[model samples]
Target chain A: MFLNETQEEVRNTTRNFVNAVIRPAAEALDREERFPSEIYEEMGKLGLFGIAVPEDLGGPGFDTLTYAVVMEELSRGYASIADQCGLVELISTLLVRHGTPEQQKMLPDVMSMKRKVAYCITEPEAGTDVSGIRTTAVKDGDGWVLNGGKIWIHNAPVADTGFVLARTDKEAGNRGMSIFIVDLHAKGVERGPKEHKMGQRASQVGALGFSEVRLGPNALLGEMNRGFHMMMSVLDKGRVGIAALAVGIGQAGLEAAVDYAGTRKQFGKQISEFQGVQWLLADMAKDIEAARLLVYSAAMKIDRGLDATRSCSMAKCFAGDMAVARTADAVQVFGGSGYIRGFEVERLYRDAKITQIYEGTNQIQRMIIARELLRKGATS
Target chain B: MKILVPVKRVVDYNVRVRVRPDGSGVDLNHVKMSMNPFDEIALEEAVRLREKGIATEIVAVSIGVPQAKDTLRTALAMGADRAILVKSGDDVSQDLEPLSVARILAKVVATEKPELVIAGKQAIDNDMNATGQMLAALLGWGQGTFASAVRIDEGSALVTREIDGGLQTIRLKLPAVVTTDLRLNEPRYVALPAIMKAKKKPLEELALADLGVDTRPHLTVVSATEPRQRQAGVKIQSVDELLSKLKNEAGVI
Candidate 1:
């Protein structure tokens, strides 16, 4: 209801594409656990990636709300596909904001999925804590040598390029970090085996190792010793994206549970006729809607240039928790069959699990929320 | 060649509509609205013709309340070069009769001077499958309704129409009318970037009086009612019992 005409139009087109192509293929993609390059090519043609990039930079140049809307719709079809879109959006946003004109040349290739990208930030020592990262990029003549490893990195198996964050100074704490544009296929870069995942398995997640990987002078993004701040600047949008994805997972589960309850019978009546089942559906619907509204409001806050830090954290925390709870309720509504594989609700329950863990755990989100509340007044 | 497509705003096909207690019409209060399914097919066909180089420009026009502009915008996003919205009424519940709609369209045709007109076979809301035929009659042009396939040759359109028994292929001269059926083609999803560009496309709005066409209702809807709920089927113990019931009760054997 808060969407404008163009936003609504974008949602309709994305929803239709998801219904026709993404949702039907989601089951096979999950079962096979392979990257669907063919689908990404079609989505690139449709300009589904880098939604907020400027029009001149070969993107749709939409606002944050529209991006959130696309994320929700795409995730509703398949979270793995939406995660790919989110990955592209972040990389493209980085390039648009920080990359030099020459480096920005990769925008079209990245957006089109011709050059797959990975945002390399998570590491073995730095899951929730960013300062503990051992990855370092040292000055070598006019260029820098990257020495680090990123674990559980999305698209590590198939990515053509990576935006790697490494420390440039050890003594400066957060100010010591710097981001670089690294060629993943270059020498001294090794890819670990693809890790089997609980959900969103279509996404190829693994480790990326870099040892003595030489970088050109133009590889440094934005400024020296500012990678942590740059990454933090994009964190709100990332949280919004993941929150929307969680909402989509919950929405898909609700739809499946509602459909199944209406058709499945018990005691000579539809299961939906039972008050207990009715309450389950009701709670699921309300929480999903509430989370959706929170996501939208957070997105709009960012779009309107407000202080959206607290709102973003709240949305991410609430949406992730809500998705986990609601999808479980959806499975409860389905009873024994929900536990079996191949059921959509079953997959959704698995898919909903990662939302609470990734994009900063729900624990970190609550900390940020509490921090903001304490820093400012409770009313603020 | 220029093709003109007339699209209607109807209740979304996904919505479960209900007749009002007053029985005047189906409830439109807070109802979801979208371009009619058949009209989407019609627009899609026109876009394809344009893409194939048979048509130079595609114009989408709608006759309804002001809110129908959304439908016309959808058409533009789907690939129409321009749009014209003729406001026929102020109330969303007021539906123009087929003849009135045809008259307004005829005026549009005379002014626009398009070489071809493609429209949906019927609107899902009212199912009055008479507008295209009436427009053809009013324009003194041949029409092909329920078109499953359309191929434009040198100076004529070869239309394969779906009939009760089989398909009938017919040829119509230039500036003909064709109404789309289900099997014509599925509409393409409007790419996100295209939707943004469509905002800059030309969309001209006109009052019904601007065309100087009489739009008095030719017919009124009587009391509307919902179809009865279907009865549940019984489970038979054996094939012999099913055969006996079919022979004795249903009498179809």
Candidate 2:
């Protein structure tokens, strides 16, 4: 509620950009399943990518709350575009916080979307359990050779670089992992066919295969045998981003439901007059507001340099569940119209499901929250 | 050459303005305010001049209550070198009228001595379309209204103005007033980084008393009312009925 003037300005700018540039092309992009590269580049030129990065490093140096605002506003227009932005922020934040001098040089290109990067943590066998990842990055002469594949990687088809986690030490379990900045175009690397998804089709999702992909010594990000810790940290921020995306989807659903209910007549009157419809709309509004508060609070905590692992998980869990449920209710508000294509709520309903599945599924979120609660003995 | 641009804060164009029930004025409580659209065009033109190496410096000036500083800051963010706010207190609503604004701007012109003055053709709220002409008359300089294109060389400016009949071109002396029309130029989006940098730009505030100008009202709005609503139309049955309605009811025939 107390967002500073700068944050408001950022929000206004993103909102206008989304309305003017993104919304019109969103449906078409989804229909064609095409990535909106031009829009992404325009966002880069507008410094949307630099919202949370420091000014000297070619960013606006905004706080985490501003980042959340950007995500929410962009997602309101289209979730795929917001997802692309989130991925970029994830890697950018990682590079800014833990990258070496050479690795940091990529910030300008990454922020401008000239070079896109995908986060490669989830493998064929490792969805929830990080220790189960078998992607090994064995040290070779002066470099490392990676020889495993990652599945369900967002933006893998279009990514130029990858922030990859590989098993550097086999005996150390999760602690044995190391992060590498692998060039997707390098020899021995192959991109599998795109994964056809139910929603968020505008995003490019696929699996990446690393058959002895060689990387230079400088490609190692953060520290060897410490990739899991770095990833856990990055996931904390990523959870907040997912929460913002959930809020956006939920907000869009609630708005569509209200508009449709007010216009569509049923039983000789607008459906909005019915008590059942009113209660549904009321609950959706209440839950969306609650989710927004949770998301923003977690975002503010991160901005203030406070630890936000537990709060981030809580926000993600609630917001994700809210998005999925509200979107379903919005479909109900539309009745038959919501089930058909051409209605935005239909697309939103499909898009909303991913919020609960990806970014450590809502199930994983519950576990994280419960673990934190158990360890801290209910601080709240 | 130094360029001076005057901007006004108005209700955001996207908002639906509502008239007060008591016939006092339009409701402004909790409403979003932004720089006037045409003023953004004027700023864009002046900024283009500076970009083309023809103008050495650009100064943005606004006359309103303290909140108008936000408008000036927006101008700064859009590439103005510095800004000046002529603060007329909240109680003096009449001080923002076109004539009062012109007088205060005339004082700024006399002190700052800019080579060119650019302003919007009209503020969106009042739509008076008089400030630029009045400022030029007060300064005894040539004026160009509804400018669509402007070109400057040495000490004269060629302004293309959109008039009722067609386009009219005028050559004005070095220091002149030009009001921007809708077709002048499209303004650029103010990026977040530019806004952050604009916060450091010089923005000086001065009271109307300090400017040595009287801001008394030259016009009065005895009462403000909303436009009359039109009644629903009825479908005509045939050409004969349409003719009868036009002749007797509408009196168009």
Candidate 3:
């Protein structure tokens, strides 16, 4: 009768753990520019890293909704954690579904947090349109020699492994694209300087370069010619992943504002006692709850393996925008204190900007929704 | 050394338990249950000891309905060696205050023969704070309650129990019971791998017949009700109003 009570419990547990353990460590990690190494280790130990991996593979064996719940809670602590999930699970799902058995076996280890991974599909030339990637993985003797480069990769430097998309054939255009799981530690592979990011400084994002880096035959992730579809295949799950992250950033902002409003006295009264501030707080709460429902709705659909492409797009776009707008409002709530770098609202405001840019871009999301609607003949 | 820490599943602390008005009992249907917060601390202590190679084989058990196995999974996820669930019927609610829970734990300790059994000083809901000492008494075992720190060396366990004023440490021989208070170390979250493996951990569910205890209702609640509501306070906007409310109206400036 209940809509999966077990699934709801999973989310609640994860949220509590993240709040108690992860949130405390979040601002420090961002302020110090240090990776949330302790959080990562703790998460790995707690199995946060492998939320969706099968139980047999050392994962919680959660459905997609459960995975979303875990992500929402983790991201609620910090958006950086959500970025890690997107790279590890959303894109990795493509590899899991279509990857070889050996590739599938590698998942449990990645989820174990014994190893780290990065995703590099965006390039200086290609951000929204992945087809323009110049990075090429050339076939060799039962292997491939990857050349060219990638920029804006999440976890580029520290990751031991990555899913790198590169062009395999110049003449074939879109069909020429291929996804490869390149070992970042391999020779000829180099990590660039960390990007001067606006937000989510806790996450290490930078460029990755390959100068004829050799990869094993097992490196090719899915069918060779179908790499474009492999990357495209509605990437709706990835959108949901980022949407949860956006909601997390927004939620953190909302909480910061509410907490500060309650404590900070203005003219001998708590700021929260003012009607104007209460209205702002109310709006913040409403936006966050709405975005949460949307993001979770998309994730729930993913768990059912239903067609949630449009819903995922809507959630991602809306959440990303909300993160930005609400974080700005949160800073307004904090007033002078929020402008500084160390304040979580400041970091949240800064970090909130990229969710809109990455993971196929908000503009691209609109296109996906439009295309789906047009195909359905629902739009005149 | 083998340690037996009894973990109890209570209504999750985060949830505000709702009591039906003029009802017979607390509404438990669809209630969110979790490992009791303090028992979680006890569980954490046992697991940490085992991980440090100070103890071998931490046995975790719970006494409740068959679904108490949920708490067992949590223990396993926290790295407890194994678990046993003593299943009691809905009549379990009828057990006089703490006697039924204490009795069931007593039976478990007799069978397991572990040197140490850790428990929570109180479940958040009942706050009865009686099960740990009672279980120890029924088993004729030495008892330690409100333990904040527990250290094991050689054959003895040194436990520090937190009191209202300060703390007191006691040295006890093997086969003692410890009930944790709120001041213990924060419990660690279950890792991904453990969550996966916990499903595979052996959980043997036993009915009242198996435990040789009668699961029958002996007590009944005449009414169940919500906490009394606080009277509404006057809204304050000005500084003077705020100060007046804090001092006179609220009486807590």
Top lDDT: which candidate number?
1
Question: Which candidate has the top score in TM-score?
Answer: 1
Give the range of the ten consecutive residues with the poorest summed lDDT in model 2 chain B.
B90-99
lDDT of 2 by residue, B1-253 (tens): 9999999988889887888778777888788888899999999999999999999899999988888888898899888999999888874233377778889999999889999999999989879999999999999999999999999977999999999999999999979999999999988777778878888999999988887777776677778888888885899889999999999999999
1 or 2: which has the higher DockQ?
A: 1
> On residues B1-253, what C-alpha lDDT tens digit does candidate 1 reach at each position?
9999999999998899999999999999899899999999999999899899999999999998999988888999899999999998789998899999999999999999998999999999999999999999999999999999999998899999999999999999988999999999988888888888899999999999888888877797879999999998999999999999999999999
The list of candidate 3 runs beyond 4 A from truth reads A1-9, A101-109, A112-114, A377-380, B1-4, B10-33, B48-72, B80-96, B107-115, B124-128, B148-174, B181-186, B200-253
Question: Each candidate's DockQ score against the native complex?
Answer: 0.81, 0.62, 0.37
**lDDT for A222 (candidate 2):** 92
* Model 3 chain A: lowest-lDDT 10 consecutive positions: A1-10
Model 3 lDDT tens row, A144-189: 9999888878888688888888898889989998889888999999
Window of ten residues with lowest summed lDDT in model 2 chain A: A1-10
True-structure lDDT of candidate 3: 0.80
Report the lDDT tens digits of candidate 3 across residue range B1-253: 7888787777777676787555766656687788888888988888888888888998888877766777888788787888988766565343335777787777877788898998888888777788888888888888888998998877788899898799999988878888888787888766555655677778878776677764454556677777798885566679988888789967997
How much is A206 displaced in model 3, in angstroms?
Answer: 2.1
What is the C-alpha lDDT profile of model 1 across A258-313, one tens digit per residue? 99999999999999999999999999999999999999999999999999999999
User: Which docking category, incorrect, acceptable, medium or high, applies to candidate 1?
Assistant: high
Lowest-sum lDDT 10-residue window in model 1 chain A: A52-61
